[model samples]
Target chain A: MDELSLLRRIRSEVDGPERAALDRGRAALLERAGAEAGIDARAGQGVRGTRVRGMGPDAAAAVAKRRHPVRWVGLGALGAGVLTVALVATNVLGFAGWRGGAEPAAADALQAAALAAVENSDPVVAPGQYLLVETDAVYGNTTNTEAGDYVSYLTINRDKLYVPADRSDDWVWVRSFREPYASFNAEGEALAQKSYDEEVAEADGVPELLRAPDAQFYGNSTVPDFDALPRDPQQLLNYIYKVTAGGGNSADGAALGWIADTLRTGVAPADVRAALYEAAAGIPGVEITEQVANLEGSTGISIGRVESADNSRQDLIIDTQTGALIGERRVELTDEGWGFPAGTTTGFTAVRTSVVDSAPEGGTQNGQFDREGCVDKGNGNFQC
Target chain B: MSTDNEIIERSLHSAGAFAEVFDRHARTVHRYAARRLDAGAADDVMSETFLVAFERRAAFDGSADALPWLLGIATNLIKKHARLEARAWKGLVASDLGRVDIDAIEQAAARLDASATARRIGGALRRLPAGDRDALLLYAWGDLDYEGVASALGVPVGTVRSRLNRARRTLRIAIDPGAARDEEVDHGRIVSASPDSL
Candidate 1:
């Protein structure tokens, strides 16, 4: 979908609760407004600030906490993800066309995926080196506005990915934006090469490996921080739901996506990978599909969820017999008309990953003076 | 209702006049706060927003759109809540459904997909940088245009565009209809340290 429409969808979801909150909150605010103006001496009804008119902030906050409606607590913010599981499970109001399956059996499939993760030995590198993997990706889809004026393009990107020697956060990526993006013009003519080219250039400067929020970047790549991740199924599941992923995406979907993404790097420790699958099983919407998917000609068993945000289904293709993560993809089942049509392959990645002894010529060590400061004293255990 | 600027200008000399300002703009501020925060915290924030605005009326820059200015102040207060009240509000989301219609909520919940669109948006918003997300939310829910968002954010209009643009793209990646396909888009790739094992 187009950016404007997406923004509208996002706004609509938040707007309803906000408007309701408005209805409930207005009376109390007017009372505070009235009290501040000293027009309502009978402020006992709505004015509930316990601290005096001008207490210092800390004291005022303490009083506010006390006066805060006691009935409105977060069910104690339970650490077990009880609320998260309940929220996801209960809120799955069934709108997204849930397909009935032997649902509980899907959990067993996930348990098997975790066991496979435990046995997986992808790669391990010594310090001062990086892991490099390469693949071709198509990043985004098309979107149209109400007036029929549309903005959309699809990119064919060949990328080489690199990460720290250890499972550290940051690394480098080299992207090649190839020609002939899927396109059509404002007038509906085919060769909108300029628009396609602009889209490609928009991604040209994206340092492949990057961080969010701050988006701190270097010349070729960026580093990410994933240090505080949980290693247990429940906590990891809770982390995805209550911590990182919230109302927008399913906890199960996000966890599955995250696990598949992390493992795609071929760098996570086996326990972390195991925990990821175990956590993914805790999500309520999970189902195993009988269909097998082939991306870049690698075929695997498909298990997926109808990911909420776009009414699209995300399938994780796994080689169940051998326990290999072949690949993953998201397919739009409902187009909503103005976006990519239904059955459009919105995204796909076939990854070939392995660890190497050193950074490529244009990678992490390129911008710096040198790595590790290899200064040495004479002994074997030399002090550098 | 009097114009917001008029309400603020009148309140400069008369303390009681601030009530009119509250009556005029409280709902707007409350809705904006509610969009960013949970319901009960929104209530506290809504009241505190106007209360503080009233106390600072003497310093009111009356030339600007008063609601935007108020929203700006409300935005600051919400940030403070985001930081200080994170734990406080995190413990209270379950009980905030007091005013919601269970039947309507259930109806809306019908046929809910595991990866429902709203949850994805929520998840994506959480992933967004606080600065960019603030700009986008202000524009979306705070009823602010680019200038209004700029005014609310205390940044240049260009900065608001940049932040909103960044936010827009990030959210699209999460909510876009096409994202569900191309499984590769989400799996994120790097390399195995021992490719030779193959």
Candidate 2:
């Protein structure tokens, strides 16, 4: 080989150490860059600055507060309280000397009224008229676009008088679903409302994708354009509350109050709780066996029944105030095609729904109700 | 008790400790970059190279040294900023113009053997295709191995070898056309085959 060719071969051989060195150098440089970028690489390392660049300080603080152990413990305690109530309501505790098969006076009265409502299929608004309606009716499967099949479930709730501005008196129906682990504001009130219209608007020019069978669409798409519908203020309020609650937890007294004030032009706690319970009972697979004597002081409700399709027994604990469902444990026999041969325990928390109710007065309003009323001040007003 | 791996692990986890890595390898990287681009461009390129390497540090395999990886990132960045590199070369050539003198030329000629060696190396490099030229320079001047050149070019080891071989052949012709003939004979002997007797 020529002297230069020989030299080149030698050079190639010598380059390995140099290449390794360069690799080492680059790795070190990247570590420094990560540190400068404010990413915590080491476990158990807290972020040094209170503020991060793109996201503000408050957002960072919120993340830290959400991750705190003490907060999680408090939520756990709340879950335990709801569980206790569920056990008591299901008569698992047997505390009130209430035994089975006597046809309790409360059940007899509610059953008779419920059966009458189902037969009439007309709205009833009496103060003590609680109805439990069961139907084989089909509900819109938000997840399945192609599998549009009806499922059987029970419905319960109070019927109220609705007097829209442009229509005659009509019965406005309201119901609440149980949601567990719902987020609340500092004042212990649920923040269930979507604060802005833009928050729900899809970006322009993006085609909507088909939802999977297991996925749910919880945005503005599910809400009805009630403003265009002619109805009384009370009817509008009931419709608005039903639409806002979105088949989720309606147990939050504040959420109920907001609905009451928005549609009825008034806020009543007793009416709100009654509406919430009705909504909870309307959910598919939900069955209300008995109404406890004092619902106001009750933390939550427990229901036991065989699920309609699978005939599997399930127990559910629902938060009474927040309408949040918790501690849902289902046990199935006969090896149904679904996995969980041993059955499964699931914990569910309520996610904030993206739908927001526009103020009836053509301005923005907070979707939450405090103690006083709807709290609709003007445009862009949010409950503190 | 800190082992080598422990030190490296600690350095990987902490950015402040990376200075030790820099203090150890920066001079060599600076020199390599200086050879590829001008000093000013090299500084910026080196900084950026390290910055990118730092950002992707989690992907590092701790068993290996990290210098070649840094150089690979630096090489890519240099390619991205090609115009800056051209300007740096232009400036280098322009500065050479100011130092040109008749006496200096005579003195340089008097040192023909040494000048010839440098010119031959440079001419061999310049004759190579841009890709091979880069591979050759990184290997010869930067002292990177075949694997290092492959890493820098993001190519395979065999490709590096082929490029290096082609570069050396081109260099031999440029340095002395007669030398090419000698190389063909030597290659034939080494491979146990005649050039035309295949």
**Considering every candidate listed, which one attains the maximal TM-score?**
1
Ten-residue region with minimum lDDT total, candidate 1 chain B: B184-193
Q: For model 2, state the Cα shift of residue A194 in Å.
A: 59
lDDT of 2 by residue, A62-88 (tens): 122211101111111222123234333
For model 2, how does the per-residue alpha-carbon lDDT over B97-168 read when each residue is reduced to its tens digit? 122234765765645543455455544554457788777667765667677677667787777777877876
- Against the hidden reference, what TM-scores do the models get? 0.43, 0.32
Evaluate candidate 2 by giving its C-alpha RMSD to the native, one decimal. Answer: 21.9
- Which parts of model 2 are misplaced by more than 4 Å? A1-384, B1-8, B81-108, B111-124, B182-198
Query: Which regions in candidate 1 have their CA more than 4 angstroms from the true location?
Result: A1-102, A124-130, A143-146, A164-170, A178-192, A199-227, A249-266, A308-310, A363-384, B1-198
**lDDT string, candidate 1, A1-384, tens digits:** 354454443324334333333433334444433333221112111221111222222222222222111111111222433334444532224212233322576667767877886776456666876667665544333333345333444445566766665443455555453344454344322323544455345445343232212212222112223455667667666555543232123444544555555555444566776666666567667777645677777777677777655466766666665455666666667754423556665555566676776654443322111122322222211121
Q: Model 2, A114: alpha-carbon shift in Å?
A: 49
